[model samples]
Target: MAKKDKSEKKKKSAKLKDAEREARLEISGDLGTAITQASRSLRTVQTRLLTRSGLYSGQEGVVLLLAAEEGLTPGLLAQRLGVKAPTMTRTIGRMEAQGFVERRGSDADGRQTKVYLTETGRATVDRISSANKALERQATQGLSGKEIKVLMKLLAVVEDNLHAQMPAELPEPIDESEDLAAE
Candidate 1:
């Protein structure tokens, strides 16, 4: 029993070492890692600015879209934004609670509800726009116009490559209960 216990300890140590090495290998020189880090930092900065205007990170996108086109059904908005229906529904619900948006039953189809910006929501457009412009200026502080254009093109290529390789639908979330025992 002692020998078996020793062997199990060795196995666990080896697994831990392997996991550490794998993590180091991936982050050191990976483009995806760099992109993820940049995105996270940008989001943090944007969130700070947006919070000052009584908006969350993703909420600005919804406000901008509705500002551009009013009376969009939730389903249509979800499709345009490339988010799931339930996600859009929750966002609209929260925005409605905040008095930023209103949903009215469509005259053509009573079952379908169309979303529109409330007067308060319309007033928020300028603040959102200013926040976005500030973010852009901060992000591009050291880059030249030509360099910025090139960077955009390269990022677009990377995005296109990843999109092409992406799965048609994401898989269900993994169950980590078995792994928790080891932890």
Candidate 2:
């Protein structure tokens, strides 16, 4: 009954292939979920650390950027920070109210306003650096240098792939201001 044996073998092979495909799909789904969970946890930790500096989750980026190069326009800041103009404007307003940054009319172009870090913001620079180093140390506590390097490279590749598939016009960013304010 060679024909019967061959038919049974073929059926088993097809089942195995199906099982492998399902496993791959499950693994991919888990990968996405894990990435999302990790990102959220990291942000939560960062927010907690930033609160000590009287900064929110997003304001630190503005402070750091201005620390490096002062007098950057809100539009340029938004572009560099990968956020919308409205978002940057809101962030700058909040920072100004907190006395971390101040805006002034540009000498070259009166219509344009440039942002600069205030004394308070500069003072927090060292604290922000310490907070960041602490976070890094905590996150990579068990990981080797090679593992961290590999992880960074893998994340970069994933980010590039996702960006390549994104549309020219991205969706609006989530408004985390309320959450930050509550904190």
Candidate 3:
């Protein structure tokens, strides 16, 4: 009877271990989906707030960066903003048309162009700051400060992990000539 009881206990423990493993697997699979969904939702909220300040989703970073430093080339802006030069050019053109920023030839270098915020753009800085504060408040409405800090730390770790896995540069193109020679 005692032997049968011990056997039953071992089987129950094995079942529990399997159940825990499945739970961990499910959570690991859900992490990416959760992060993506959260990001989309946050962006939606941010866009809505930015619209009130006469800016779009990507324009705020440009405005804020230009506000801090009066003149920056579109290429520098693209690099800092993690976007391509052409995208930054389009954004600058739109902002110029909207009277938010203007491009001028660099005094130090005749060929280089520098972007500067207009009076309208400078005025919108306060509004942008307010919007950011409001967004933060709303996002952290339920969370404690300690929880928010932990979340930030966890996210940084995740971002670092992802960055570590990404290739530093694209692979070189294969030479068709070499391929033909090999063939």
Q: Give the alpha carbon lDDT tens digit for every residue of 57-108 in model 3.
A: 9999999999999899999999999999999999999999989999999999
Output the better candidate (1/2) by TM-score.
2
Pick out the ten consecutive residues of candidate 1 with the lowest summed lDDT. 21-30
Q: Which stretches of candidate 1 lie over 4 Å from their true place?
A: 1-28, 167-183
Residue 96 lDDT (model 1) = 95
| lDDT, candidate 1, 39-88, per-residue tens | 89789999999888788778888899999999999899998888999999
For model 2, residues 1-183, the per-residue Cα lDDT tens digits are 999999999999979978986776677577787788678878899899999999999888898899999999999999999999999999999999999999999999999999999999999899889989988888777589999999999999999999888687978887889889999
* RMSD in Å for model 3: 12.4
Scored against the true structure, residue 113 in model 1 reaches a CA lDDT of 99
Clashing pairs in 1: none
- Could you give the candidate ranking by lDDT, starting with the highest? 3, 2, 1
lDDT of 2 at 84: 100
Index of the highest-lDDT prediction:
3
In candidate 2, which residue pairs get closer than 3 Å at backbone N, Cα or C atoms, i.e. clash?
Answer: none
Determine which window of 10 residues in candidate 3 has minimal summed lDDT: 21-30
